[model samples]
Target chain A: MGAGHAHTLHHVGDSPVHRLPAHVKIVAAFLMVIAVVATPREAFWVFGAHLALLVGIWVTARIPVAAIAARSLIEAPFVALAVLLPFFATGPRTEFLGLSLSVDGLLAGWNILVKGTLGVLISVTLGMTTPVRDLLAGLARLRVPGMVTTIATLMVRYLEVIAAEARRMRLARVARGHDPRFLWQIGPTVRGVGTLFLRSYERGERVHLAMLARGYTGSMPLLGVPTTGRRTWAVALAPAAAAVLFATAGYA
Target chain B: MTPSLEVEGLAFAYPDGHQALFGVDLRIEQGERVALLGPNGAGKTTLVLHLNGVHRAGAGTVRVGGLEVAKPHLQEIRRRVGVVFQDPDDQLFMPTVGDDVAFGPANFGVTEPELSLRVKQALGAVGMGEHADRSPMHLSGGQRRRVALATVLACDPEILVLDEPSSNLDPVARRELAEVLLGLDRTMLMVTHDLPYALQLCPRSVVIDEGVVVADGPTRDLLADPAFLAAHRLELPFGFSV
Candidate 1:
């Protein structure tokens, strides 16, 4: 529930990015990612342009540089896999800074880093501006499976409750003089996780019944009377469209 | 007009061989606000669950609005019976208040325009219209409870079944909830340990102890009877004899 927690990633703002329709943003993000992935690794200039375009968009959206850096750092571990490729990969050997590296490995690493960074940036930007509900609404609008959207919606809604339950359970255990610190004490933590899972499962059943009582048959309805104006779509697509054209010019 | 609800010889037992309800029988008239008072493990919830076909009756029948609560009428029964669970967290499962409110109507196939109107009107009824876009978790306990009620109200049910509706509310919120309940025109079956809330919101009362109806009468008269309330583990607040 703390503001800096992963679940609380959304930043309240009045930027155009914040006002963009979720469905449009979702589609645009997907298209941008596909375009990035399809771009060859040798297109170094295109990658540079892509990064520049993203940076420009981020700046125009008024997202804080510190926030972006923190999120990128959080995502750094996944990108670290790509970083390792340059050293471990087998190809024509090259020496740099007293270390051996491979030509193919360098290209592989560059490809992953650029593609992964772009993908993560798109997702992080989406998460930071749009509330979780809007994301689900957007997914629903984009014809993602209803069940998938419903499950994601339910999961996000109950995540806090589940986390709170875990916290309460931990406190209760600690009050009973259970100190789970060392490897040997991991038993209690495992048992706690198991208990949490069971509690969550039971809660799901109860929630289903509650839904039934409220006349829930299956599909969840769209949130808010969607006032999807042309301006909203136009604004959302501008950055993605610009990025695509910029990346395309690199193809020429 | 037919009664809002009728249960005859309704019995249930868990798979572990523990019988919860032992041939319980009850009748609720149309537009009647009745409180179902019982101690813990007295099958109060088990009985209410039967009204909407959540819990199947083991040995008898549950009828809502003249339709038998069977598989064929399950959806219809649910549409007409709005159940507000004790835990608002469990009730409001959707991410936003608006989605949660619209859930019931959406399932029942209310058109888009009608659905929006119902969601708005329902939230308005609970005085939570401004919070439609807000996440349910972000709301206070009272607000969540109001949204939970709105979720049910959106379905436009004829019989509102609320379990411990005022359990966790502060005094002001509890009073706000009481006023909201009072304003609703539908027949309500409220299950609660709070005798005062029952007395305030319901005209009639039914006592369930050990899976059976032990007493049924006017709320005031029943609460006034010391022996009757004590028999079912109910007590008026200190110095507030009924």
Candidate 2:
């Protein structure tokens, strides 16, 4: 249904990271993130090792350095919060660049910036490598309840369809001289969202009918399930194993 | 041993109490191709829904291969009646082309080797063998329509019900789709407004309006009748005639 779809974050390639079965990559990525999160924020070098660990995978995956950097900007808001932390926090004042800054605040800011950036990187790397459908399939393979995964998969599939419909409705609105750019015209835009909701609901009804026509019978039949073997898991988790070792060392 | 499809005294009304079909009867024998003609809101979709047991007959019967379309036999009826809905987007919901094609047979508990064979055969039949891994989103409208057809064709149904098979295709796509439809050997009930498509692909045509059958005859005879076309609001394209 949503086949052949590559979300914008996904960069299609045949790199080793892409070649790994989605479930294996999913497990490895999950473990890597958990290892990073478990490290003491005071263990500053450990965060760099985590960053380096991701970079190694990124290099292996053949994803562009620039693409990862571009999407990792999602952490910018948190970065801004970190920047404000040194100014507002009041513990253990110190001088830097002709201004007094709290010593504890700087460490706290560093923690947020470093951990948040690494977290975002992990997510971007995973998202860029695995298609959403494959990720969901991997979740299902991990024994997630079937109904939740099915609903999520359908939502992802219709996201594009609904977006296209909204775009068409926007064009129709503009063609009729409705200027959507004006701040004062927010009413129409908001109203348009409501209309889009109604349209999407109706389309969902029709899609349900179509599924039933083919014998949907209240549950989705599993298809194209991957048979991930032991070797694939071992290979994919190697970097994660390294990260966990570094995290353990940080606790020392 | 029985007709591929038999609809007799079939009637339906929505939960809103709006009657859409009134005592509709249709019979298509095995290997026959019939065009269902109707204006907007002619209850054509309602009829198609009943053929697969999606909607229960308000007052009559819809039989496929002599099996009644009821709760107990719905799965079998659905397997026997492959419905390609009016919109490809509405029908193609799986993650990839191959998965969508395999959806039907898999629903009937057909597994593994047999399922793959059906998916391969169906995609190959529709000239889409190479696109099995592609998403329906990446395909053009015509390609999507063909894949939608493959999704149902994989079931190897006795009768194929196509809703508006030629609605939004360019000329070449339109002709290509017609060729695919013509090549299929199963009984077909194509609900379409394209008069020439009916002429090119189906030998017989059935016209329904309001809530009942208005006319039924050969495609040429039905298209050639000026009064019948006008009476039913069925219009041929400009300068096109039988």
lDDT of each residue in B1-242, candidate 2, tens digit only: 58999999998999999999999988988899999999999999989989999888889999998999999878899999999987899998876788888878899888888889999999999899999887788899899999999989998898999999999899999999988888877799999999999999899999999989988889999999889899989989999977
Instruction: Assess candidate 2 and give its TM-score to the true structure.
Output: 0.93
**Residue B21 in model 2: lDDT:** 97
* lDDT digits (tens) for residues A117-213 of candidate 1: 8888888888777777778888998889989998998888888899989999999999999997789988988999999999999999999888778
What is the per-residue lDDT of model 1 for residues B30-142, given as tens digits with 9 covering 90 to 100?
99999999899999988988889988889999888889999987888999899999999999887668878888888787878888999999999999999987778789999
List the candidate 1 regions with Cα displacement exceeding 4 Å. Answer: A1-7, A224-252, B15-17
User: Which pairs of residues have clashing backbones in candidate 2?
Assistant: A1-B93, A1-B94, A1-B95, A3-B95, A3-B135, A4-B135
lDDT of 2: 0.88
DockQ, candidate 1, comes to: 0.63
TM-score of chain B of each: 0.98, 0.98
Best candidate, DockQ: 1
